[model samples]
Target: MKIKLYCRRALMTLLFICALYTTISSISNITLADMKVWAERVQQETNHPSENSLKKSNLEQKTMNEQTYRPKTLEEAIDFDQYETATVLATGYTAGIESTGKTSEHPQYGITFSGVKVKRDLYSTIAADPDIFPIGTILFIPNYGYGVVADIGSAIKGNSIDLYYDTVDDVYSQWGKQELDVYIVEYGDGTLTEEALKALNEAEALQVFRQQYIEQ
Candidate 1:
């Protein structure tokens, strides 16, 4: 009777161990399968970008470019509603040592601050305080027609301008220091790009600029 009882207990113990081993093996197999699936999903995303993500990236780049874009021309740059009439203290100057403190032998003799050669007479070159009128600003003087602000003077501050003349005699005889009525036709884009400056350095570029933007 004792031997039969011992065999029954041993059989029950063996069955319990077998059941635990089966449960552990099943859990291990399920965990390995889940890991394999997760790794494959990560690799797929790494290898190929989604169409929606690509479109989003492109849209972001376009928005950034639009925000940074600047107008390159007077027509595109200026706001006509901002135009106003102004009274200015006007002086006269020629490309001479007395006016510019530079001789013809100097490399920057005829060159204005905007990198353009000075043109004489009506609708010609003028100097002003760059703080008020930046390079490429167009002003219409009652007697002078139209003059572009392309230079700056040490003494020209606030509402003041130094009109350019062909000769020193013209400066003395025609225009001296006086008050003038001037119109602010259009404001400049307030930029001096190296490419634009280099192009303006050409002899005929001033004529082209005048015809395109000023003569009208």
Candidate 2:
């Protein structure tokens, strides 16, 4: 009977050991699964780039572009869109604007209503021979600010250009076929500065003018 009791106790001890083993195995499995999930989360965080990081990268690229910005080249600017070869331009302006016929028709632009589709603004517009200064040509006059080759005239032939005036008296009083310095801003594959681009963009007419100039 003692021996039988001892065997029964041994069997009970074996069952308890098995139960302990099962509990330990379950705990080990749960811990391993948790470790796997944690490792995967870590990997994802390491591999994926954050939204802020991407934005920062883009900002850096933009900064680099700004730091390296440059205007247009004269070598490229001198080549006319239509002309096979670029011609040397005369340095001075020799012409005058008279409000006659279509010139006095209606103002194209500016505060005052002076007739022609082009304006009377100094930097905004100018009249030139289509043969010499084609429409949409950007010019830089020394005393004058910036002007475009917007209109053509019979009297505006050759290198002579007609500056716009409010009245015929203003035309004769201001400039009566006098010589003034004139410069072409750009021609052919010219580039505009950021400020210049902003200015051009603000004006719809200038944008169209630039497009026509570029396409040519």
Candidate 3:
């Protein structure tokens, strides 16, 4: 009888241990899920919403559902401009990142430099070829460059270009307030199509920017 009782008590202990393990495992999974949700919410709140975010979310869902996610090939990624209004604006170094000791928010995203400092109100200048370049067109700088169209400048009225320098030292040493040639790549249909604008509007692009600021 004593041996029977001992066996029963041992069995009960084992069952309790198994239950504790399962509870711990469940709590761990919940914690991880909560962290992921928090990160996503932070991203949506900070960056402007756009098609990029939509695409990314779709990709994430596809990956979860289908177990795979792949980006477009280099050739597929290249967007060529075809609109008659499309123009090639002169390019220059984006100047502020390395100089300011800050990394780019989006390395793939490109912009024209308007001045040495980021203005109090995000004001800056671009090349004087707005007729060719237009105000809202986006361009890619090969390296050491970064920017977005926040505002235009009076002095930067024409084919002339402005370079961004994070600090006075950067202005003198790295940028030197010079003009450089920038290449404009065309993406999607000609004339800054709604799709292209939507692409720009996507949350992924803004999320990239937010990440940069957060790290800084």
C-alpha TM-scores of all predictions: 0.51, 0.36, 0.31
- Most lDDT-accurate candidate: 1
Model 1, global lDDT:
0.73
TM-score of candidate 3 against the unseen true structure: 0.31
Candidate 2 regions exceeding 4 Å error are 1-98, 102-116, 188-216
RMSD of 3: 17.6
lDDT measured at residue 26 in model 1 versus the true structure, 0 to 100: 88
Name the candidate that leads on TM-score: 1
Over 45-111, each residue of candidate 3 has an lDDT whose tens digit, in order, gives 6785667778998988887876453322322233423322222233333435543334567542333
Please identify model 3 stretches exceeding 4 Å from their true place.
1-129, 185-202, 205-216
lDDT of 3 at 57: 86
Clashing pairs in 2: 105-115, 106-115, 107-114, 107-115
Tens-digit lDDT string for candidate 1 (1-216): 999999999999999988876787687765556768979987986798678878989999999998898554444444534669888999989888998899999999988887777875334778888888887777876555467788888888999999888778877777778897777976777644445533543436234334433332
lDDT for model 2: 0.51
User: What ranking emerges by lDDT with the best candidate at the front?
Assistant: 1, 2, 3
Better of 2 and 3 by TM-score: 2
Residue-pair clashes, model 3: 15
